[model samples]
Target chain A: DQQVKQNSPSLSVQEGRISILNCDYTNSMFDYFLWYKKYPAEGPTFLISISSIKDKNEDGRFTVFLNKSAKHLSLHIVPSQPGDSAVYFCAASGTNAGNMLTFGGGTRLMVKP
Target chain B: GAGVSQSPSNKVTEKGKDVELRCDPISGHTALYWYRQSLGQGLEFLIYFQGNSAPDKSGLPSDRFSAERTGGSVSTLTIQRTQQEDSAVYLCASSLDVGTAVYEQYFGPGTRLTVT
Candidate 1:
């Protein structure tokens, strides 16, 4: 059972434009959510994260928005750059668990110039 | 200092063989995790070690897959009698603590294991 799910398999955005990737989760117990960027043949790098108590958290050009009621979260990249093109995976953590992250299938983002 | 690093960038082994993958975590990071990545599937948790605490092997797929952490720093994941489906990129990560916003897990390039 995939607790975290990214419905979109892929997304395309124009350079310098805004890009939005959406993710959903089935478990309401998750308290912390994070987004990671992964390149080909490389490990995923942490981008940003948000807590359930907060609705949004921003870091540089990346912002994560969380809606507890909807069990939905989104990662927004402003002025999307070509370098930002990679697979984006959404992960979650709960207080009960010892921070054993649960990751989604990931969404492939492509930025076109 | 340097981030997490994994050895044996690529390994090709025959079926029914045994393979060992290694991971060196970052300095001062007590929490270590192992994950398996397969095509179309995201990171699958394999095992984790935290300080002197008992390791969590709940995510391990089967009895054939096992891991160990020595001196609470480096870890080794061993797969015995591996099947073709066991072929996947094995990734290792290190974090500061558990269930905290400080979960900025630094990851390694990963060891690509191909079971023929």
Candidate 2:
């Protein structure tokens, strides 16, 4: 029984275009959501995060939107560049459970030139 | 000034063997965690340790998997009677604390274990 889920396994977008990655969770207790970017042979690094209180959060070209009622969230990156090509994972943490972050499978994003 | 370091970046071992993976976390960080990532599988929690409290081992898959943290700094994950199913990339991370509603988790280069 996976709590967090990333329905898409792979996504491709043209450079300078917008890339959208989606994720959903079954656990209603999840309050804090985060996105991680991973490169081959490297660990997943924290990219951005949003609290349940807010519906959206944005940093530079990266924006994260959360729909608590639907238990869905999406990450939007505008003007996607080649350097953005990597595996992106969605994770969530709650207050009840030891603040442990449960991660989704991940979506491989390929920005084509 | 190191984020996190793991020894033996890659290891290949035969089935029924035993192996140990080490992790060194950042200084003054009292929280440490172990997670495993199989091919096409999401990262799974293995264990977690804080300052002297009972570790949350609920995530451990089985008894064959065990870990220990010394002085709340370094940690070692030991797997006994390794099985082919155990092959995966083991990752270690450290945070300030758990259950604090914090989203910052620092990770280290994982140790790829291949069991034949």
Candidate 3:
């Protein structure tokens, strides 16, 4: 079963616009959530993360908002650039899982210049 | 300051053949994880190892699939009599530890395996 899900497979937006990526989870045990960006033929790199206790966390141009009650989380990239085009995967881990990250199917973001 | 590294970036083996993939975790990192991404699918956790701790094999798909971590550094994943469905990109990742704090994992470029 897929505990984490990214419903949107692909998203397109104009450069300098805002890009929003959404993820949902069914496992309440997950307490830490993270986002990773990946380019073709490369490994995913960590972007940002949020704890279950917090609702939002921001770094630079990327922001992650979490809603515990809705079991939903989202990543927002402000002033999206063409370099932001890649597959973004959301992952989650719980204390019980021993740092094993369960990842979503990933959403491909395309920023058109 | 090297990140996780996996060997044999690409492998194409025939069905019924056995293949072994290797992974070298970042230096001094005590936690190692193995995951695979199949076509049009998300990453799937396969196994995990921590400093002398019993490896977690809960995610191994079958008895044919197994992994071993030697000297608490490098890891090897072996698939025996592999089927065509075993084709996927196997990824390795490492972190400082698996303590209470959530440590961000660094992943390797991954080893792509294709069973022909």
Give per-residue CA lDDT, model 2, range A1-113, as digits (tens). Answer: 89999999999999999999999999988899999999999988989999999999999999999999999999999989999999999999877756778999999999999
In angstroms, give how far residue A40 of model 2 lies from its true place: 0.7
Scored by lDDT, the top model is 3
Question: What is residue A76's positional error in candidate 2, in angstroms?
Answer: 0.7
lDDT of 3: 0.95
Per prediction, fnat is 0.62, 0.69, 0.76
Q: Least accurate stretch of 10 residues (summed lDDT) in model 3 chain A?
A: A93-102
- For candidate 2, write residues B14-116 as lDDT tens digits: 9999999999998877788899899998889889888788899999998999999988789999999999999999999888874464747889999999999
Off by over 4 Å in 3: none
CAPRI category for model 3: high
Question: Model 2 clash pairs?
Answer: A98-B99, A99-B99
Q: Residue B17 CA error for candidate 3 (Å)?
A: 0.7
CAPRI tier for the interface of model 2? medium
lDDT of each residue in B1-116, candidate 1, tens digit only: 89999989999999999999999999999999999899788999889888889999999999999999999899999999989999999999998874444477889999999988
**Superposed Cα deviation of residue A91, candidate 1 (Å):** 0.3
Question: CA lDDT of B105 in candidate 3?
Answer: 90
Highest TM-score, which number? Answer: 3
The total number of steric clashes, by the backbone 3 Å criterion, in model 1 comes to: 0
